[model samples]
Target: MAGGSFALPKPRPSGPPYFSRNQVANVLHQVAVLLELQGANVFRVRSYQNASRLLGSLSEDLGELVASGEIFNMKGIGKGLGSALTQAITEGRWPDDWIDLHTNTPPGLIEMLGIPGLGPKRIKLMADELGVDSVASLKEAALNNQIAPMKGFGAKSQQRMLDGIELLSRFRARRRLDIGLRYGEAFQRKIAAIDGVHRATLAGSARRRKDTIGDLDVVVAVDEADHETVANAILNLSGIADVKGAGDSKISLILDTTIFDESFTVGHIDPNVLDAIGGDDYEQLEAGGTIDAQVRLVPPHVEPFTLAYFTGSKEHNIAVRQRAIDRGLRLNEFGLIPETKAGDLKGMEAAVHSLGAADEAAIYAHLGLAYVPPELREDMGEVLAAETGSLPSLIETSHIKGSLHNHTTLSDGEASLELMADTARKMGWNWLGIADHSPTLKIANGASAEDLLEQGRTIQQYNAEWAEQGVDFRLFHGVESDILEGGKLDHPDDVLAELDYVVASVHAMTKWRGRDEHDNTEELLKVIDHPATTVLGHPTGRILQGREGYEVDLYAVLEHMAEHNEEGRLKAIELNASPYRLDLDWRLCKHAKGLGVPVAINPDAHSIRGLSDIAYGVMTARKGWIEPNDTLNALSGADLAKRLVR
Candidate 1:
């Protein structure tokens, strides 16, 4: 849990595969745990533990460090440990002892180590005293009241283990959108390189950009003659660890996440999660995450139809199929043909060939509809909108000018203000906003009012320097002020009034969610009416796959925001773009658009890398029918600053 996710080296065609610094470091960390569990010498265990942390913190390339022999010169790593790290990186082979330790350890004990606050020592104690080997056995022990009497585990601790097991089960059921996309896109790329693959596109919920995905779907186009060759090649891809089934037309695979490159973000998938689900489940859920994938091979002629069928929200497909039926035509993955009698198969094939639908757009043209973007394929009136030629041009990533809710190291962010600003300039953005946490949220090292004011002066100084250089960029100062119980903003109006904006968010859900829905709605309404409140952050307080949003009357809240905007108060709802919390749920974004209440696609970023998360927000915006004109951040800095003025 100390280092980033441990990933197996992806297979390389020409040279030994490369391993990320974190991957190497995590391997050491796992070895340390194994050493301790095996009762190795205290100094020996400490060596691995110290080296793992050291390697994780190093920015240098692991292979280069090992090759130049600089790793041995480092403080904690001696020759023996350094040699193990070297072999893993240069030869793409984990140290023999590490593999042997894994083989000998009961996989159940490894999983038990994943429980929060349960370390290797605690796990060893459990196995020795109660003979608990797996999560199921641990759960059984806890349930049977056998764990409570243990010296270190009381009733409270036993209860927590049960709860942690439940949470782990839920995490394994599906993967977050970010994780799914990383694997799906990587798999599609590999498939496209196969000898005869004409085209490869991701389908299913992944194509629709859903917040969580159960399995990935990919549709490949190939000549009929190449189906067998292509399918065989796909099964042998490096990441395709397990084949569920294989055929000329379809292949089911379990993609190993360990083989994915470090470019894929794995920080969101906690290391504790990987540690707890060991063995086969551990392989299935690679430390970064693993997923089941299906590849469908179709002839080039039927590719369009197959893509559409697979890239479906079931309801959307059903509605379109019904339309075809009403027109005395049949729409299937193969093609659109006349709805003829069963005995007229030859005529049906002829009719399909004669239609000459070349692509998904052409297929839609045959149905008298405009092209519906895959994101809009949900059956939420998209069919009717397309038929009427009334779909709005959805927001694109380029439309964003700047975000008004981001953080710096002054609060909980990983980058400094200067670094964040420099990154934004390189990104070709006109402005960036710093809305570090207010003092009430101590967990984030929330900036105090004095700290906030000082930061404002720092921002002013940056603006002055930019102007002196004739640069067009600007920085707005603000706070992600907590919406306290009963709807009070964290800072007083006097403090809030000095800043450019305020993002009022409900962080302590226990207080707000404890009330009735009406009361919860009223609390948010109070924030909306606050003269200093500029935007509402993560409106639903929902984290995809982690938990459901708190119950509140979002309709009433959106209406209040709309009413305030109509009164010229200029309220905006933030579509928090952190992949984990694409809140303001796309389902409600359209309603906000209709209410004429501007939506702000704020990344709510905690680091400079996090700034790119806005792309995910833009996708969700497009899915919700949001356009450039409907968002606050789409405005240039000058326009946005003017609008933020009360």
Candidate 2:
């Protein structure tokens, strides 16, 4: 009306633009890589690396630190880096020098950095010595017998380069769950707040909580009279990079992530996550990334049907459509209509009246079935279970009372023990476990037996003090002990017995990956049979899109855990909650539940912010039909204490 036509509300300018902590850290990390590739001073490169690590580990708001100029006071951040960070954080732009370095670097060299086993040093060597800059050129060199003759690289190493290049191609196809949610939820919020939109909800594989997502889908409900206005408003939203298509019912867009408002919580991303999805790709996602999104607009009368149809696994939709056909009805995204001889019922008027459904649940009820949740809509016995009223009471984030697998600065983790405990307490957890890396995992800076015991005493002191103050908080000390050759754990039984529990994980990937599935399964069975082993951590060692994980028959491994658990020994399988490794794959979680083996939803966190990754794990658990009773995270501190005393 003010402009002679309806207009969407403009977002208020919030002074100077500020970047998320993640964005600043990522730019700094990129600068370090670029400098290293250019053979810049080693100390200069190390400064950026240290700054990146420090900023990443910080729980404080980076914008506030920059505003107050307090970041300059931190150790290792000199005036030069501090000014650069200030400009990057407060101005929403990288410094010109850093940009120049990035610009001069070949895009192919950056891509090669992600090709596992290839670091900045080796990549520089290839570019200079063999004229190989990209994966394509590197592959050509390897195929032509040029790489084997190079110094420090033999035939075996040449083959690995070939293998890694193939893996890199697959990583480009889909973004991980966390990255997809960042863009999807951001766009959904923007559209939902528009003037003519009634309600907006995320749909598609993202809504179903799939671990990897291709494109995003958002459904919006609007009155018939407001369709044009709402569609215009969405296309005009600030983050839209391009309008792929616009129609009365559907609008497609390519969203730019870099332009989103500060209201979106761009949380800390683990380095492993960055590596799992290629670093160059993740950097693009953080700095100037674009994702494809479709916004579906439907009238309020058919909103329920539209939402349900769009939030689907195709197989689940087919099953429900078949169910509708069997009952003399035709169900589609518009509405459920009766199978009349005259097909005039295709219009919304006939269908809404015929179905008399107002929501997704009501639609299910009308079909003589209970409502199936979005996560369970994968066509894996859910239709029959809903019909029989036997669907599980799936686990939620609130059901998690504590976690048995976490880390601290004592090992590779970024957060110290005290900070980790405080963060857990703030999350309203009654207990928190510290399972730092054990002695043999040297790469992780594994804690020696002495150091671990010393940390246990500190935890004992904290537990005693909390008890004295009636805080109802406790801490458990554990170690993520490595499972070595022949199934022997990294730490001796004598040392392990001194801890509250033990998390046995495989860090020796080379040896484990060399074995066949049967052998790998047997190795896992031996770890389960160990008297001190409390949980199996990240059972598959898979890094989502990055690695295929070691070959192991997880079903056989779960069976072994089940057998051990039934014998009155406490054994559980960890659903490692890192977005990069939701291992104990969701597909296998139900089998673990069926076998009566408890699932431990471990964050395997390395920082204060990482504790919240449990939310992703909960989504995975619910997808696998796991209930609260089937997971160790749902157990109370006191109850879990008793359960762990094997």
**Backbone clashes under 3 angstroms, per model:** 0, 0
Candidate 2 backbone collisions, by pair: none
Candidate 1 residues lying further than 4 Å off, grouped into runs, are: 1-171, 262-265, 268-288, 341-354
Q: Mind giving the per-residue lDDT tens digits that candidate 1 earns over 85-125? A: 77876777777778888777887777777564577777888
Model 2 misplaced regions, further than 4 Å: 1-171, 263-276, 279-281, 341-354
lDDT of 1: 0.80
Per-model TM-score on C-alpha atoms: 0.71, 0.72
lDDT by residue (450-490, candidate 2, tens digit) is 99999999999999999999998899989999998888888
lDDT of 1 at 169: 50
Candidate 1 at 352: error in angstroms?
5.6
